[model samples]
Target: MIVSEQYGELRGRAFAIAYRMLGSVGEAEDVVQEAFLRMHQTLRGGEPIASPRAYVATLVTRLAIDQLRSARARRERYVGEWLPEPLVTGPTPAERAELADSLSLAFLVLLESLSPRQRAAFLLREVFDYPYREVAEFVGTDVDSARHLVARARTRLRDRRPRYHASREHREELARSFFAAAGQGDLRTLEALLAQDVALHADGGGKVPALGRPVTGRERVARTIAAGMTAMARFGVRLEPAEVNGEPGAMAYDARDRLVGVLGLGLADGRIRTIHSIANPDKLRHLGEVSDLGLRARAGERPGRET
Candidate 1:
């Protein structure tokens, strides 16, 4: 019964906040739905809202903070490294690199180091460009306290935050070459494109085979990626170029065209600094039909290679 011209834009913004705060697409979607439902109820009750945008944002942010707190324990117990659900954005026009960097898996993983309220305050102030007063109101803190929260978050992420300096076209071309070299198992070319301290992170979530810990250093990471690509080839998996979280990346599909995984890259100093491979079926479901990777793993199936 609640219909408005601003509903679409509001919903998009609400999802963006929830997704950044929680780093889970499904949970963010649920939070947005619930937040809007509450909005409908409030309006139906004849409650006059001064600013629907601010109200919805506050609802979504607080709800996401609560969700993050409850999810902390589960993440602590999660098998292998827990990576954010990949947001496979395909070929969207380049926005501000700063904004794009904030959505990277590397940045999201670094945010995991912060406490829930700190994370919320930092994202609201830094990424979403919210004022301290509004951030305080959303997170239920004073203005000074909100500033303190954001400052502390900045301190914690100071060393680990990702920086981007490459042009969008360069990033895309580099990513294409990087993925191509990896697919061909070209170790030399792969190493040439990677930073000396580059790291490869794979999240299988205990559903399929994956590296238990991050593979670091150019030599090690390159070898790991080359080997993994070989294994994927044996199982008829192919990589399709994509833009994951606003950065150049790729998606893995099985021979039957079911999405099996997503790969995202982090670039700094004109070189790939981080490689994020998300293969968890649960995480891939939102993108499209998810391949039953677990079943294949259990059955030890290795079909013929495909182009």
Candidate 2:
């Protein structure tokens, strides 16, 4: 069979896997494209794949893992904050909700705690439900090593409680409320809505000035974010809602509409639990345009708005 015939069926799964692995849509796209190119090269050389879907998935996973290894160095030097690129896919409500938790900002941040190999092992086994042997093969390790890696990653991630498990609509509403309060500079409302132990993390790739450490406590985060937003407004920084990790989030743009930053929200029990803001210019390459808040507002007005 020709490559084109199989491309459509494989692309979504390939992208999904790569996105979960790299946490950047742009990187995921690059990995998927590279995987396809390799597939084509093999096919043109008259090599047959035993299972095209599995073959493509494996190829993408390997490419993403390699990319992650390099990305670690880049992230270490990032400007202010580093956030994953938002994925705004057109999917059904059910499908979008199913992916929301796995793709959320908190989840992606938690993945950062693991080494690249461990991340690959954990994602394959947990997210993709791959058997230990399959994950080991994908990462070029023994089954026991892969199992250990997955186990270690899981233990670290378990500390971070799961975010919103309610319906997508409910979660989106909560995000909107948070955004509205932040935009309006309603400190009282913001503090009330945020959990007492809320944490704010910024990934600036060490290029931009950002909080070098995580900001914890509801009062401290609220004051810090509010002050930052106040300064941003003075310099014409704008925030607009965008989809990050399949959930409601925001992106920041300067007066020139240049992509400045991306924000990710972590919601627990209908309150803001964590905030991740990525301001590194290098990381914002995937966010082409400064998303207009007006547009997002209108989009949300529609019934059953699914991120």
Candidate 3:
């Protein structure tokens, strides 16, 4: 029971670490659960293991690294642009702001560009605040190699991330306006709300058809959104606002309550700069369970309005 309680207490942070590493809730939860199982077995075996928390965390991190390595092949052959499965983060705590910021879809997308080892090394050293020595231990490298890995990762990530810091209320408000305008197929309003260099990326993962490449520029993105919203509406799909990854996002549901897709937006200078759509059924499996957005969407939404 003490072991179980310890596992429970550490589960949130464990899940957070794994999720940030792998960008998939189901995969992260699997890693966390496996770590707990291993820890429980080791404890029950009467083995002398010190610091259950640290041991379990390291175990989870290594497990997530393996998962990331294996997941890369599928991602390479992915139908469209691959995206991190949305985690549907709720209100951010001031104390956990660092963790919250690292979970953004845009940030996760940037992390995706790195190799599995570099990602693990960088995440451990940077986001999780582990020292270079510890990050080396986590990624199974020397301290110098770990430092090099983090530096390379950081250089690659620089300027690839959104200029974050907008209030959730502002993001949500903008999301509401964007969806309403897009739902109505109002190109003028859509263009006005979009940044000049806005980019829209859709991930369907070959299970379904989506934009194979990013649609960039305000005019192009506006055309894509307007056409997409209109086409979805014709197919009985409805778009409703839902908070995703601690930012304003939307949830799409068909008339029969099946989830169509999940979307997250990156706002810069109070305008939508990046739009991410995840329609891959494989990636979306956990959104039904982990996504608070799913319930409101399943409950029902009115047409052409914010939820």
Best model number under lDDT = 1
lDDT, residue 9, model 3:
77
- Going through the candidates in order, what is the number of backbone clashes in each? 0, 16, 0
Off by over 4 Å in 3: 1-5, 289-307
lDDT of 3 by residue, 253-288 (tens): 776666778889888888998999988777777766
Q: How would you encode candidate 1's per-residue C-alpha lDDT over 1-307 as one tens digit per residue? A: 3357689889988998898888999999999999999988998999988898899999999999999999999999999999999997753455556556788889989999999999999999999899999999999989999999999999999978998888888998999899889988899999999999999999999888888999999999999999888888878788989889988889998988999899999999889999999998999999999887545764677665444
lDDT score, residue 7, model 3? 60
All candidates: TM-score: 0.95, 0.83, 0.88
Candidate 2 regions exceeding 4 Å error are 3-5, 77-81, 142-144, 206-209, 254-258, 290-307
From the highest lDDT down, the ranking of the candidates is 1, 3, 2
Better by lDDT, candidate 2 or 1: 1
Give a tens-digit lDDT track for model 2, residues 1-307. 6456567879988987898888887888899999989988998899998888778878987898899999999878765556676654446677775566677777877788889888888888987888998888888889999999999988888857365676767767888888777778888988988899899998765555567888999888888888777756765677887777677788787666767677878778778888887765556666576433323322443222223
Ranking by TM-score: 1, 3, 2
Model 3 steric clash pairs: none
The collision pairs in model 1 are: none
Each prediction's whole-model lDDT (CA): 0.89, 0.77, 0.80
